[model samples]
Target chain A: MVKATPLAIDIHNLSLWYGDFQALFEVDLQVKQGLITALIGPSGCGKSTLLRAVNRINERLGDYVRTTGEIHVLDQDILRNDIELAQLRRHVGMVFQRPNPLPLSVRDNVLFAHRIHRADEKFNRRKEDEIVEHALRRVLLWDEVKDHLGREATGLSLEEQQKLCIARLLPIKPTVILMDEPTSALDPKGTAALEELIWELHGDYTILIVTHNMAQAKRASEETAFMLLGRMVEHGLTEQVFLAPREKETADYIEGRYG
Target chain B: MLTERVQLSTSIDLDHRGRDWYTDKAVTFLVFVGGISAIVLIIGIFVFITKEGLGFIAGSLDVREFFGSLAWRPTSPTKPTYGILGLIAGTASVTGLAMVVSVPFSLGAAIFIGEFATGRLRETLKVLVELLAAIPSVVWGFIGLSLLNPLIIDIFDVPVGLGVLNSGIILGLMAAPIMTTIAEDALKAVPDTYREAAEAMGATKWQVIFRVVLPAGRNGLVAAVLLGVGRGFGETMAVLMATGNSIKIPTSPFDSVTALTATIAAELGDAPVGSDHYRALFTLGILLFVVTFIINLTADLVVRRAGRK
Candidate 1:
């Protein structure tokens, strides 16, 4: 008997429209368990839209955002009405394009989602400290921010702030993390540092990162999905897709032609 | 060629002296005058009030009695006393009650307008609130006299309905629309990014607003409430009619009271131009100016602190 591979996120024929402007059309993608999956495309190519679709946050932009799609995260169909958004979000955390640490203390920003999910639980300060420490350490930010836990999170540099943003999601025990251009705002050094952090975090959580940088997509992810306009052109092992692209459009994009 | 180059260098005219430059200079001058006029007018008013009230403060006025004694019998026949303790108490009490009435309603309205209401409803509610603010103060006083008076009497079962309770409710209603407008602006000033961040964290809509938006907008809300309190303290005609214009320290909401603004509005016309009573009233005007200045300063400080954070 053949062994089956586990999938963390399975999206099927996903289509999204912001009012009358359709941004994504009939997109299909599979993110395997415990691996980094990078979605790369030109601007307005719906890569970020697809990442946001996994967490189902695009609908909150406005009621006019209409989506006809099936997005299943961790084998659960998130688009169905029976799913509780709060519960689904607890399992699937997201990092925005900008480093948006809450306007709170570093300790509170990490504790925020944990507190929300565990609202009914008895208060335990020791456990909370442990959670904060573990989450921060997982993002390799514990030593940098350990002495200044009470300081405001927004005051941190963009690189540290982005790390803190990812750190905040860890306490919730999220199974999947969707990142939208996680390093687009970082400097070259910051980007290299963050990529190191992502490499360190692999095999523990399934991460889906969208990036405009093709080099980053190739270097960081095990699997790479190329999108054009609103459709997924190709998705394969990162090395194979970048080295011997199956499609002519994929080859042209890789060669830095028209974005 | 060298002579041509020297001539070209000599003829270089870089100064912008066209009609646009003249227009810019004229506008800069006009705006400077316009801006300075406000400061000049404010200082001029302060100087005039101080000059008018100096005679009383320098001569026969007892500073202690003006603030300490409750006997505000300014027009007494034999021993005319100018004690304003009772008026101070009355004004403070009515303003306090007005704040009590206005804060919840205005904050709730602000939250609804800023967070919940959508599309046509939001615009409609905003326009309605502005319209409410535009209603004449005299009309509000009339509402207090004719509408609220009988209603309070029926509800509270009191012999007379016009008092602190009446004026407080009336002033509260008068202040509420403006407070809502300002509070909405404060909430609007909070970035949408914070709300998005909270929502993505699995916070329900209420949790997002209560935890993130409210905390981020705390200073603006406090400033809004302070501005509302300032308005309540300075209001005149509405309180004059609804307060029944009685000079006494109000121990209860039912007790009739007179406010400082109401006293001046009622008696300044009858008092002779340069009498001791006139100077006393101007002294009250000086006090009003200082209190309002302090309130405005506190609001500015709170808003500036928000900027620093």
Candidate 2:
């Protein structure tokens, strides 16, 4: 038997509806292991919705929602009813558009994931310090926040807060991280910094990011998927997708003709 | 050309004189009236309370005996004791008890209504809580007398239904709705971003409520507690009916007691004119006024701090 490299996420023939309105139609894609893939689209193109569907976070929105499809994460069907949301979410962490740190000390925000998900009380002061230090260091936020770990997280700058959120996600050791327009609210310098961090993190984790900036998609991703009107118009290597798009719509969007 | 320019300038001046001047004056006058009315009302009420309370503070009347003595029997001629210590202690005990009973249940209900329930269920629970607030205190008192008092007495094997326990329970029910409603509003005012952040970190629903939502709305929660305390302190009919109108300090939940508002309401109609008893009732009124003032001031400070944040 010929063996195939297993994909991290596989979505096959997925359709989603919010009551009478259909949002996505027969979307198919694959996320490769340990690489950064960017989903680029205009506003209202269902990019964020599709990202939310991978972790089943959309199911918590309301009862009127209906989804017909199969989504697989780590070779396990995640759309099944028996799939535990908490466990799935623990493995698939997310960062939102705006930086939303808890109204707590910086240290607590970093350790929140472990405290909530891990039931072990035996991790004393030394282990806790190690975990906090490692998580913050991974996101390059340890030195800036080390002295004021006891200070409130809300008092940080927007860039620092977003990085703190990333640090928070790291403590859970998620297999994949989903970012929805992570730098849309940031300044140019902040955006460049976060882009660098995303590239650095691509070595160890699968990253699926939704961004409207074509340059950012081109810069940070190994693979890029272009979506328009809730449909995936093109999916290929980042270089090929930008230079030689298969569809005219993808080329036009990348060329800034029409969203 | 010069004549044309002068004519155009004159028309512009006429337009401004016709509409702008009158509208601006009317708006300014209306604002002045509204602002002055509010200030006057506040100052007037303060003046009234202070005028009545000054006699008790002045040395012309004995302050030590009035505040320190135990007995509150005003009609006894031989050794009439008009101490406010017992009444003040009684009021504090009842108010404290009412808060203890109401705070937890009201907060739980608020969290459930605001964060946990589905759309229709949340609407239904909210309607019920609003109805609870709308029910008159006198009606609550009647319910306590006819229904709750008997039940409590039977369950606890007490001699009478009217006691500290009965008043506290009734006041708790009366205050719970306000606490729940205010707290729900506070919880709802917390931005969804905070909740989403917590949930994204794989936090359980309960943990999100306790860790993220509650802390984000701490100032509002404190305001709600203060509002509930005010409601419990000023509650008159229910406390009067269920407390057995006792003047002694309450030693336990089963003992009969009286609160400041209850004392004023129960004795004001029969208090003799220009007598020490009348002055003492005014004094009770002063105490109630001070309590409400302090609670509202604290609430204002908390709200301001939250706004600054």
Candidate 2 per-residue lDDT, tens place, A1-259, comes to 4325457888999999989988999999999878899999889999998999988778777777789999999989999999877788888989889888888999999988888887866667888899899988888888899999999999998889989888888877898999999998899999998998899899698999999899999999999998888888889899999999999998898999986
Model 2 chain A weakest lDDT span, ten residues long = A1-10
TM-score of each: 0.94, 0.93
- DockQ of all candidate complexes: 0.74, 0.70
Q: Evaluated with DockQ, which candidate comes out highest?
A: 1
Model 1 ranges off by over 4 Å: A1-3, B1-31
- Score residue B6 of candidate 2 by CA lDDT: 38
lDDT, residue B68, model 2? 89
lDDT for every model?
Answer: 0.91, 0.86
Per-residue C-alpha lDDT of model 2 across residues B45-105, encoded as one tens digit per residue: 8787667666655623567877887778877878666787877777778788888889998
Per-residue lDDT tens digits for candidate 1, residues B1-309, read 355543335566788599999999999999999999999999999999999988888976997899999888777778878899989998999999999999999999999999999899999999999999999888999999999999989998998899999999999999999999988988998898898888888999898988899999999899888998889989999999999888899888999999999999999998889988888899899888899889989988988887677
